[model samples]
Target: MTDQRANWTDEKDATWMTEMIYQVVVLGKRANSGFKKESWQAASSKLNIEHRVNYTKVQLKTRNAEMKKQYAQVSQMNSVLESQRSDACG
Candidate 1:
């Protein structure tokens, strides 16, 4: 049986994974469509080995998608807020 702690990814782990993914994208491993199989494997391996976790590629991919969704939502909200502020000032 796998340890629960090993399976669990906390906030810090998620942030670390995000940073790694950004680095991967910066290095041209990720394209507009998404990560390729080799890139996924590389990111999964790096996270498992360096972060001492046991996340599979699917898990990492799912988490990345979730983070992207959250980021987009936040960005949209910020844009709306800024627009409202401009209207109020104008």
Candidate 2:
């Protein structure tokens, strides 16, 4: 095994730069958002489509509160996993 700091050198730097350039070119081609305006508009239209439902302010607040609670639970689980990983390694 080699020391972490000692493993880095000019060759590694050049390889990293080449990989980054390749990734950028590939991702740019895959992301057709700039060229496909009609497709983007269609997707947006689909996403923004809503049903006609009359909900009171209190009902909306209750739904928003439930969503926040679910989000916090997921975030806490992620944090626990991250801390466990750091503790196991170090």
Candidate 3:
């Protein structure tokens, strides 16, 4: 059980986790913008095995929330930028 705080610093681990969560959702493990407990547990276990580090369901959930927030922010920024461009070009 190595330090999980260090696990996220590795880009490979972060990318793998993001992809794994997306795959889980695409596979229908997610419901109503949330994932089932077992789904999270499975993701955590798989990541731990693949990355050789310890991670918990809570960590995965937190990361998912953080990623969603970030994505929303980026989307909003892009939308605003597109609107500005439209106004300028109009």
Candidate 4:
């Protein structure tokens, strides 16, 4: 829950989640793809990889510019972890 991205029962992250859901919905809409059950399931899988595992760095940042601060924090942490992993291996 409190691994890094704060994917727990917190207000900030919960807000982020709500924003993300709306984003995925918007993405589907813009693509002219209806939010069918299967499509949503697939998109959810792709978006939640990092949060669910609290390990993966990949994620779909929302288009909401107001959320850039929160998104930036996550992006920074991911890059740092990636750099550390590279160092440990090489």
Rank list by lDDT: 3, 1, 4, 2
Which residue pairs in candidate 3 have backbone atoms (N, alpha carbon, C) closer than 3 angstroms, thus clashing? none
Better of 2 and 3 by lDDT: 3
lDDT of 4 by residue, 1-90 (tens): 223553433543454455446655665433454234443344445445634533222222322333667789999999999999999999
Candidate 3 local lDDT, 1-90, one digit each (tens)? 433463465564565567566757577676676676667776777777777778766777677787789889999999999999999999
Cα error of candidate 3 at position 83, Å: 0.5
Q: Per-residue CA lDDT of candidate 1, range 1-90, in tens?
A: 133323445754565566566656676666677666667777677677776667776777676787789899999999999999999999
* Candidate 4 residue-wise lDDT at 89: 100
- Of candidate 2, the 10-residue stretch with the lowest lDDT total is 1-10
Pairing residues by index, what is the TM-score of model 3? 0.74
Better of 2 and 4 by lDDT: 4
Best by TM-score: 3
**Per-candidate local distance difference test:** 0.69, 0.43, 0.71, 0.49
Which pairs clash inside model 4? Answer: none
* Residue lDDT tens for model 2, 1-90: 111222324443344334434444654422443323333333223322332223333333343366569889999999999999999999
Error of 3 at 1 (Å): 5.3
Better of 3 and 4 by lDDT: 3
Show how many residue pairs clash in every candidate, following the order shown: 0, 0, 0, 0
Cα deviation of 74, candidate 2, in Å: 0.8
lDDT of 3: 0.71
